[model samples]
Target: MILWFTYILVAIAALGGLLCVVLGLAGRRPSDLTVGILGLLELGLIAQVVISIIAPFAGNPPTGSLLEFWVYLVTAVLIPPAAVVWALLERSRWSTVIMGIAALAVAVMVWRMQVIWTVQGS
Candidate 1:
């Protein structure tokens, strides 16, 4: 994994999470803004997936257990869509909060993936 891209993903996810949290706390239900932010986060995750696929061929193969890294990557890619679906169906302030939590979770998971890719050994 590229270190800089990881940082970018974390930043986007963290900021989006915080924004959703604040909106939820302000008594808002899920909105287009929240969904759009999640959509962007999902796009970033998809890009990360592509990069991970290509990086090994480019001579940046992960030092960690490849299975572990792939598992984390796949799960991280799923979170945003899951949260968005939940929010859409629930349409409650708490659902917005759940989306925030999901985004925050993705940020942490992405960071873990970075550690596994760059620091851990198989």
Candidate 2:
């Protein structure tokens, strides 16, 4: 995994989590901006996936087992869209909570990716 890209994902997730907290505390519904940020996060995740795919062929196979890598990749790619869809249906502060959960999950996934890479490297 690319350290810089993982950092970018973590940064975006942190920002999203902050936004969710602000919206929840203010008793406001999740806005388009929240969803937009999620979209941006998703884009970053997709870029990570693409890079992962290319790296191996470029003679830089990822450190993790393929199964572990795929699990992280699929979850990272799916979470934002799933969160957006689920949030849209709720229309409450809970939607923000859901977004928060999604952000946290992304953060965890990035950490896991790092761990997987490190374990493989050793």
Candidate 3:
């Protein structure tokens, strides 16, 4: 895995978390800008997933279990939309808080994925 791409995604996800948390602390519901940030993060995660899936086929497989890598990748990709849907359903500042947590979770998952990619027997 390219370290720069991982760094970029991690930075964006961390920023997203901070943004949503701030919005929530301000007692505001999830706004379009917040959703847009999540949307962009989701797109990046999806692209990462695509690259991860293809890398193995291109003879650059992970040293770890490919299935585990994919599971983590998929989970990371799905988190933003699920958070958005739940945020819409709740219609409260807590929903924004949920997005913050989701973003943080995705960031952690991505980090674990990087470990899984580079560390043998992970």
Candidate 4:
């Protein structure tokens, strides 16, 4: 688990969250641009999950409880798509706001995962 990659991913998630929030507050619906940004964040999250799965075998497993780490990872993996679905269901600025919330959650979760895997490394 490269710390720099994880840190960058976290930053992207945070910035993505801020973008969505700003769009929502500005009275804009979930546009193609927002969806694209969310997709990119999802890609990063999925990449992290893949990394987490392979890290154990690579001899750098998380020192914290694997169950908890897996739980957080799985939840993070679902956030973007779920938010997109929610935004699709309702075509209002608030829908984008919901996605904004999801993005924030992704940021926090990514940061937490990094702590579990790197800071607490066994």
lDDT of 3 by residue, 72-117 (tens): 9888988999999999889899999899989989999998898889
After superposition on all C-alphas, the RMSD of every candidate to the true structure, in Å, is 0.6, 1.6, 1.3, 1.4
lDDT tens readout by residue for model 4, 3-99: 8878888888888889999999999999998888889999988888788878889998788778778889899989899999999989899998888
How many clashes in each candidate? 0, 0, 0, 0
lDDT of each: 0.95, 0.82, 0.88, 0.86
Off by over 4 Å in 1: none
Instruction: Judging by TM-score against the true structure, name the best candidate.
Output: 1
TM-score of each: 0.98, 0.90, 0.93, 0.93
Evaluated with lDDT, which candidate comes out highest? 1
Residues 36-108, candidate 2: write the lDDT tens digits. 8889888988888888878778776667677887798789889988988888998788887788788878888
**Model 4, which residues run further than 4 Å from truth?**
none
- Residues 1-122, model 1: lDDT tens digits: 99999999999999999999999989999999999989999999999999999999999999998999999999999999999999999999999999999999999999999999999878
lDDT of 1: 0.95
